[model samples]
Target: MSGSDSAAATSRYSAFLFDMDGTILNSIAAAERIWGVWALRHGLDVASFLPTIHGARAVDTVARLALPGVDPEQEAIGITLAEIADVEGIVEISGAADFLRSLPADKWAVVTSAPRDLAARRMKAAGIPVPAVLVTAEDVAAGKPHPDGYLLAASKLNVDARDCLVFEDAAVGIAAGEAAGATVMVVTATHFHPLASPHPSINSYETMFTEIDSDGLMLLQERGA
Candidate 1:
């Protein structure tokens, strides 16, 4: 579903919603280092468990595992603290900063499964600007795979969810966006392998560009178009 393969190449939306970690920046190395250590400590297979942790809140991911003697909330706090302390290897997705900068600031929001502090830190570390409207894990009663975050972001932007476009990189986040009634665009900048999706996708923001019409609607399209 690369940009060139779909009608999304010329799609226009009133606003854009973006996921934080995998969508706007590459935090896989830092995340895996911390989560991998925690997984080993819990007697879980690092390789098998790491993939499940992305695109959702730590508490939700931990609770879903239902590990014996583990308090999901407490463990999530510990993990967040560790993540906040380690921003090493975090970098912006190619052209992410420039692409975001090109958009009207009020026309976009960042919806992330990461807690507020961690999201801010990671965005800062990657040199990505923090959006004025950010819906973090704590802001919503539920994380991705639920529409709360994206819906809230749309609400805060004073736009209809259906009129917004969501940019995401994980299944749960994509589900959340769709649940919010937004068209989704997948970002595979951090993916180790190709992703299969019906939604339009881009390997990096470098492949796309933004335009604002006279009516102020934002258009997302392939670079040369």
Candidate 2:
């Protein structure tokens, strides 16, 4: 990690919050394949539409499009089923599995825009452990770009949202983390394009290390320090 990344390292957090898809795992290929088919069926330009959906609930994304004769809720349900059925391209982000395993199970949570079943299936396929506190779309009335999920995850972990470090990959997820008052770390392991953000950013967890102090506060830093 560079000196510019020290902002996140300087904090002692009680818990860690993570966004699933682009943060800990890469589901973009499978997701875009399915969504592409749906987009073409709806007369949308696949190339342009796919990028807008990451880090957001499928229902929320679909509802925002306002496609004629489309019921957002039903479309989202179908998309979820397809995603669950196809984990062909799903894989962990660089060092994600080992990094997650190192954390105290109760001190971290996954707050995702995906539904619970789909999230579980993807984590299993990627060989990442399903976290103890997994907050899914169904658990919150609203999704990313709203602080509801992250805040709820912190609540479930018995910690303050401000005392957690959030790992996210998309603009919406980052917004959600910040809105929840958590320190945000941008994970770009699965990014398809460059992202510019003021928050500390890392492409992989390979060189990152974590320590838990006597008071149970967790600190994340580059290895070999």
Best by TM-score: 2
TM-score to native of every candidate shown: 0.96, 0.97
Model 1 scores worst on lDDT over the 10 consecutive residues at: 1-10
Once fitted onto the true fold, the runs of candidate 2 whose alpha carbons sit more than 4 angstroms away are 2-5
lDDT of each: 0.91, 0.93
* Candidate 1 Cα lDDT to native: 0.91
- After TM-score superposition, the amount by which residue 42's alpha carbon in candidate 2 deviates from its true location, in angstroms, is 0.4
Lowest lDDT block of 10, candidate 2? 1-10
Per-residue C-alpha lDDT of model 1 across residues 1-225, encoded as one tens digit per residue: 365446556667999999999999999999999999999999998889999999999999999999999999999999999999999999999989998998888999999999999999999999999898999999999888999998999999889999998999999999998899899999987888777778888888886777889988888877564
